[model samples]
Every structure is written in structure tokens, then in C-alpha cells.
Target: MLVRELLKNFQELANKEVEFTGRIRSNRQGKNVSFLVLNDGSVIDDVQVVYKNETKNFEQLSKQRLGAVVYIQGKLVPTPNRPQPFEIQAKISEIISECAEEYPLQKKEQSLEFLREIPQLRPRTKTFQAVFKIRSLLSFAIHKFFNEKDFVYVNTPIITENDAEGAGEAFVVTTRNDGKYEDDFFGKKANLTVSGQLNAEAYAQSLNSVYTFGPTFRAENSNTSRHAAEFWMIEPEVALNSLKENIDLIEELIKSVLSYVLENGRKELEACQNFFDDKLISRLESAKDSKFKVLDYAEAINILKEAVKKNKNEFEEKNIKFGLDLGSEHEKYLCEKHFGSPVFLINYPKEIKAFYMKLNDDKKTVAAVDLLVPGIGELVGGSQREDNFDKLILRSKELGINFDDLSWYFNLRKFGYYKSSGFGLGFERLVMYVTGATNIRDVISFPRTPNNLLF
Candidate 1:
């Protein structure tokens, strides 16, 4: 029987014999009685087993080390006076696997930094178990939310010849060592995709709505708590959707997923709240209930400028002017201090945004939007794509993008393509926001960073 099953049905299972296998989380031995805390990863809590000296292997069982696997045949009994509702009275017990005395995780609490070094064994810890559990729940919630909306999921190519973001940060994919691509595997230069939005857009032209959830690669050299060389992205493209409709879609999706996690991941959230952040649960509730605030980019800049005037040292970036890219500090201030909720900053300068964003009638700004939350700066970024062939071609040439590589993408506009809007949400950042994990490496199973690539 699983620990969760046994605990949930303990009243009906009283005095009934049960068998289960789990790893010893902690053990307490007395002169005559011994107690073992066992967990099998089915739930956040563990089960307590009591065995006395009457057992033949009492001495050996009492000496079992933490993390040692064990099998137990026991009877469920109510513990009216104890903290827990019930426990197992062990009738027979056997050690299935032994653990070494040199195990890294001991009784004392280990720091998150120390746990990062042992990624293989970190999942066994309570903190990581909760973090990963919430991660899994969030991934499922995203899929369910999109699937219910009748959005088609598409798998884009991992290797491609075009850089979707045109940031020149894509990892080169080639088999030749001489830095030549004429005779390479694909007979031309290719790279790992940084975003799948461009490909998903093609499918949305026909499917009307499509999404891509997969791993993306980047070659950035900076090492930060928020940046990773490899990460997962959730990008959705919708045909015939304007900028306002796109914003509505993002708000609905976020609220739906938040509601799903809040309903389904209570235990995990409580575990995280007890360890990582004391107000994690309440903050999530506020986010799910509150309406997201919307502001124009120019207006947000004015607000920041006024804040800076009120206090000269309010922001590190003192020059709060138009057309300047907002930093993480600025974004957090807007959402955390100014609005106290998620804020949507829209209509950014065309020079700062990607070339694919639709240019406004002013010919200076693009119809781009970024969703900013309290803790995390930007959770989702999207824009209404430029549908005019001539304007897109002009933007591409202005940015000096290789026209030959993106010929197919340009052809989408020339064909019968209509207005399409979409956005990319960083999966790791969402996990961090929901789980209260300060570092991006903790949420991911095996994080790929600049200089570290351990298993």
C-alpha cells in the first residue's frame, strides 16, 4: 500500500495488516521500542512505524541508517494522543537496501547551495520534492488549460537555419571543426532554436491557434540566478487575434493555471511555505484573485521618474527616459511597489523590440506587451506580429537580418496570412514564482549553466 492511500483511509484500515516499502527518513531507537519515519515519494509527509524488541531483528532494524530502503508488514493503529492521527505498528520488518554511513544528507538541515552539488540525490530532500511536485503540476496545468481552449500543440524543429529572435545568441549546430558549413551535416549553417514562435505561427495560419512547449537553447555567457543556457519555453500563436485579445488570452491562461495549482497542489504549497517563503500561499491566492493592472510604457516611465524625484535613490538606473530598456529592478518596482499586482506594460519603442512586432501608426513604437509580476520581473512577452509584407521586409533589412535564411517566414506574410499575436513564457521563471524557489537551478532537474554541466 502507498503511504498516501494508507493515510487517507486509515479509519477503515484500523487493525488491518498492510505491506509497504519506503526509505528511512529518520529513526529513533529506545531500550525496548523503536520508531522509524519512512517515505516513498508518494506524498510530502512520511509514515511512522513502531517496532519493539519482540522483533527478531530489532537491533539491526534500529541501526538502519537514514536513506536505507526497507519493507514493512504492519498493522494500522490510531494514536489518539500523538500529533499525527495514526501510525503503523510493525509486525515484521526487513531491510531491502543498506545505505553508507558517508551519505551527504544527514539529520541536520543542508543549505540549498550544498544540495546543488548533489543534484542526483537532492530530489530525496523535502524541499526539492515539493519544488519538483509543483513543477510537475504547473506543466500539466498549462497543457490542460491550452487543450481545453482547443489549441493545437506543435513540435517545432530543434535545429534550424534562422534565428527567431535575431539576437545572435543561438548555439551553432555543426559537425565540422574548421568553422565551415558548406559541407556540414545540413550543407548550410544551422543552430539550435531560441524560440519556436515563428514555426508555430505557420501552423496558426491554418489551425487558428497553436502552442509549442519544448526546450530552447542559448549561448549567453552571463551567470545569474535567472539566466540559464538551456530552458523550456511555452509559446502560443493565435490567428486573427489583436493585441487586446492577446492580452486577454494571457490573463485567462495565467489565472486558470494558478487556480489549478492552488486547488491541486495544496500540500506541496504548504511544504514550500513552511520552508522557503512564509507568505507563499497567501501571495499566490492574491495573484489568482486580483485583476492584473495594465499601463502604457510611456506612462510607466513617467511613474518611475516621479518616484525617483520623490526619492533620489529610488532606482539604480537614475535616468528613467523613453526608449530605454527597463531593467529587472525597474520592473519589480512597478509590480511590487507601484501596483502591488501583476502589471502589463505595452506599446514599447520599435528600436528595443524584435523585428517581427507590428509597428504602430506613429511609426515609432510596436504593439508589444510584457507581463510583470511581484517577485519575477517579466513572466511573459508577446506582440502582434507585423502582417504587412513590405513593412516586415523593411524591418528585416533595417536590422541587417539575413533575408535568405528567413525567406520562408517572409513568404508567410506574402501568402494569405492574417493578423497573429503570441507570447513566450519561461517555464523556469513560472516555477520559481509559484514554488518560491530563489534560484532557477533549483526548479530544474538538471540545469545547464555557463560553466557547470553536471548530472
Candidate 2:
């Protein structure tokens, strides 16, 4: 399996002979000469193969289909003066596999919607090739970021009886008969976890700095582009950390991740630039230099009210007083007009947030934060957990949650107490930020959105 990276060999080859196998992306035949474009995933660009009468398979290669695979032995030579830098002067060539005339992918453009239908074959196309490559590079960058910072990577449980996010909607993990769960998991009732905050918090208390990067499930019925039944979350928790410290760590983490992807995956970024506003890369780079704007819930309300007065809000107001959940529309308006980039909306009203959040001095707001990007509304959501036993139990009761199911979690606060703060960064949303991808479905390989499970 000899493979060559065409770009790596920039210098003119001095009668260098090489043997390689690759797919024929394009083909052309002249009176006495034939040319074939070949690529083997070793590089994004294809190398040109020039075959002459010295090869008996010239006729076979000339009649090959567009996507057929072929093997060629050739001497690399400079193009002399042409569009390409070099060309392969083939001494011998043979057809490895025939791609029949019915091959779906031609050398023409296809709509993303149409391409989505052929998920199994989309990678052969240039756009998806770049997208998936960027996806791999970004995942590596995320792991590298935490591993270098001494954050222990923790694998949290996927099936549980608990809803860690307290969102009340989770897909039940059951082996049932006709949707009846009486025979599932010993009839104990289990569901896929929506968040790993509680489990990750336990580890952070011991490991000091820990994180979980895994798939999380939610059964919410909202069929929006941002909502998904299954998605990847990057949750990082730190011990003895204040709310302000949590904000600082998040800003640093996001900036570092963006910088890594931008530097390592520039080609993919450029390939998909037309999908977003032209200022996408520059906007991200500018965020690295600018300070993140931090505002409390009250301050945010004030800003919104001011915007409303000035008619800056283009959409309908949802009675967004102080204690309401901000929708995606409101969030985008805030970041786009008020903040100009990434903003940390912190100290949310405790009654609206989860029970585990630490109570602030105001007794009304919790130590919570949601990082809102300009295009994507909420990129990361996190908070400092309440370490006090009595307060935690009281908050749990206030939220009408069954304390018996969470006895083990409370035991941590009862015995060994340590303050911890963490946040869940939506992995797909991060990709959307880096690539300017609009829908969450486009970023994930096979998105499990509502009513769409064809894959």
C-alpha cells in the first residue's frame, strides 16, 4: 500500500520512480497521451498521472469510469509550464476496481440536503471530506487541551435513574415489552443521563481537576436545529473554584481550543468558509484578544430593557423580566448588539436554575453562567455546586425533587465537603462556532434529531 503525499514533494523530482494505488477522480484521453487525477486520502489535492503507449493498459485506463480505482508505476517529473506543479509519467498502469457508470458522485456539485440522504457515500465528496477531517482534528484538540492542563478525563455513566440537569426529560434505557418498563433493569426504572455534572462533581472533589467528554441524551420534543436527542458534551469541573474563577477558566479553554483548530485545520476551515459570514475566522481570533464581557442576570435584564426601549430587539420579547429563561433569539441579540462577541451571562435566578447550584449572597440568584457566542446562542452552561449539606437538601426539596433518589450525592456533601464548579460545552455548538455550520445536524456525523433517524 504505497501512498504519496503530493504536496510534501514540492521540489522537482529527478527521474524519481514511485508505485501507488488511488481512485481516479477524473480521466481524459488525448491522441497518444492520457491523464488521470488520483487521490488516496494521504492529501486533499489529487496528483496527475500521464500515461503513454509504453503502458499496455492505456486503453483500459482511457475507458475507466470517473470513480474507478487504479494502480500506477511512474516517474515523477516537473510540469515544465502548466497549471499543476508536477505530473506522473507512467511506465505502467492497471485498473484495480471498476466504478460502474451508476456511481452516484460525479465531478459536479451537490446540495447538502441531497448529500445528507447518501450518508454512506458523502465522505467521498470534497466538502464532507474537509468537514469530517476538521471534526477529527477538533476532537484531538479538545483532548489535548485538558490532558495538558492536568485535567483527569472521566467517563461518566450513560444510563441512570437520575436526571442530573433536572430538566425532567430523558430517554429511558429499558428493555421493555410494548413500552412497558416493568421488566427493564430489574424494574428499577433507568434513563439516559442528560448531564454528568453530579458524577463529574464527585470526581473533581477528589481529583481536584476532572472532565468528561461523552455523548449525552435528552428526550425533549423541541424540533429545532439547536436541540438534539443525543449530543456530545464537554464537562470540566474544578475543586476550590469560585464562580469568577470558573468564568476565567472557560474563557481560556475556549480560546485555546479555537486557536488549535484554526492553526491545525486551516484547510478545512477555508473549504467551508462560504457557508458562514466572511468575518467568521477574524471574529473568533478577535475573541482571543478581547476580554469576555461578564454580566449578572439583573444587569442582563437592564441591558435587554434598554435595547427594547431603543427598538434594537428585532424579535418579540418574551416577557424577559429578571427570572425568565432567555431564548436563542434574545441571546443572539444580546451578543450581536450589546456585547459584540462572547459574553458570560452569570448569577441566574436560583428558582429557575437547577437545585445543585450554589446560592449566592443575594439569596435569589445562583452561581450559574451561560456563555453565549455571537452566532450560536448558548455555547456552554455551568455553575458552582452547593457544597453545604443543609442548603443542598433544602434546595432539593424546594425544587420538588425526590431526595431519596439523590441520597448518595448528598452523602458527598455530608462527609467530605469541597467547593467545585464546572460547565457543559455543547460539542456540536463548538463545531458550529469553528466551521460556521448553521444546524447542529451538520456538525455531528449522524445527528439524532426529532423524527429523523434514517441513518
Query: Can you give the TM-score per candidate against the true fold?
Result: 0.98, 0.93
| Top candidate by lDDT | 1
In the range 124-148, model 2's lDDT, one tens digit per residue, is 7666667777778878988999999
The whole-model C-alpha lDDT of candidate 1 against the native structure comes to 0.93
lDDT of 1 by residue, 107-140 (tens): 8999999998999999999889999999999999
Worst 10 residues of 1 by lDDT: 53-62
Candidate achieving the largest TM-score: 1
Clashes of each: 0, 0
Off by over 4 Å in 1: none
Candidate 2 ranges beyond 4 A from true positions? 1-4, 10-14, 30-33, 52-54, 79-84, 178-183, 275-277
lDDT of each: 0.93, 0.84
